[model samples]
Target: MTNILVVNSSALGPHSVSKALVDNTVEKLKLSHPDANIVIRDVGANPIPHLTADNVVPEPETDAQKAARSLSDELIGEVQVADIVVLGAPMYNFGIPSTLKAWFDHLLRAGVTFRYTEAGPEGLLKGKRAIVVLSRGGFYSEGPLQVLDAQEPHLRALLGFVGITDVTYVRAEKLAISPEERESSIAHATTEVEAVVNQVSAAA
Candidate 1:
């Protein structure tokens, strides 16, 4: 069975566009591969603590550090075992949420997630495809709104650092302007999600 890891980073919970996208993608995946193993981590609901001096102080491991490290290890293990990863990232101040960044910090350990080689830095996690579902209040797909899209580039850079270059980004933009535009944007994004589902299913 194919193993899929899904990360949902939306503070809005069930009402979140990002969560909706992830849900739709998972539904599509189920249709394609009923036997697939799917694991979901909702970072926004159960927020991960940001790294601090205590995390790297090298003293007796505190409960906070231990918990943080444990969560990070689990996340990394999930990625290592998964055949595909789907992530939901809602833009915050033109960047990723603090909770998501915290998750990244924990997963990105030196000599574990990545290492420098003669050629360049080699990411340890390989043979995995990642899809990031992003939602924005304003239209930031292209052209005039391009400059406001820090979410896409930031996610790509961080995931790429972990050797996940085969990544797809599906965006649900202009979600807060009007009811009509929101619905239309969501429909368009749902179409993209279906396309992604088919693509991944075919490859699998």
Candidate 2:
């Protein structure tokens, strides 16, 4: 059975557009693979502690550091075992949420998830697919604002660093612009999600 990992990084909880898109995508995936195991980690609700000196150091760490390391291990383990990863990431200040960044910090471990090679750094975890659902207040999919949108590029770089190069993005833009814009954005995203589902189903 396929092991699917869903990471939610929206403080708005159920009201988040990213979460809604992810939920719809996951549901479609389930229909395609009934036996797939889905695991969810809500980073926004239970934020991961930011990386600190104690957590990075190997000797004589504090209790908080130990806890942080443990959580990091767990997060890495999830990524290691997942066949497909789904991220519900909303743009915050033209970037990803700090909670999601903290999660990425834990997963990007040296000698574990990635290591330096003669040519460059090589990722250890291979053969995994990642799907990112992004919700934005402004229209950053294209045009001048696209240059300022760092969320998708950051996620792609970080995930690629960990060997997840097959990444797809489903964007819902201009969500806060107007009621009509919000509806159209969500509808377009939903269509994209369905297309992805159909593609995955066919591949399966």
Candidate 3:
């Protein structure tokens, strides 16, 4: 059976496009892999605290630091056990949400998720696939606005650093353009979700 880790990082709560897309994506994933075990992390609703000097340094830790360390361990363990990681991210100020970034920060432990080699840094967690759902208010996949897109690149680099190179992106853009555009974008994205099911099935 496959282990699917579903992470949603949109602070919009019930109104979040990214979170809804993630739900739709996961449903399709479940259809493709009926026996897949699902694990959920709703960081948007329950945001992870940003790393402080106390959390990152090697000095004697306070109770809060210990809790932070334990949380990081748990986050890393989730990624370590997942065969498929599904991420929901809505663009915020040309980048991903702070909660999601914090989640990534916790997982990127030296010698744990990655290690330094003579050749270069090597990712320890290998053989995992990531499906990232990105919702944006404007076009960023290509064209003039693409240069302003810091979201996808950051996520790709972070995931790649941890050996999740087989990453796929599904985007819903032009959301805030107009009502017609929003409807069409959502329809396009909904149709695109079927392709993901096919892709996963083919890999199986």
Best by lDDT: 2
Mark the regions of model 2 whose C-alpha exceeds 4 Å error after superposition: 59-63
Candidate order by TM-score, decreasing, is 2, 3, 1
In candidate 1 the C-alpha lDDT for residue 136 amounts to 92
Q: How many steric overlaps are in each model, in order?
A: 0, 0, 0
lDDT tens digits, residue span 54-116, model 2: 678775378877887887789999999999899999999999999999999889999999999
Instruction: Name the lDDT value of residue 34 in candidate 1.
Output: 97
Model 2: residue 90 alpha-carbon error in angstroms: 0.3
List candidate 3 stretches off by more than 4 Å: 59-61
Q: What root-mean-square deviation over C-alphas does model 1 reach?
A: 1.7
Residues 1-204, candidate 1, lDDT per residue (tens digit)?
899999999999879999989999999999988999999889999997788765664542888777766766787898889988999999998898889998898788778889998999888887898889999999877788799788999998899888898998999988889999999999999999999999999997
lDDT minimum window of 10 residues, candidate 2: 53-62
Better of 2 and 3 by lDDT: 2
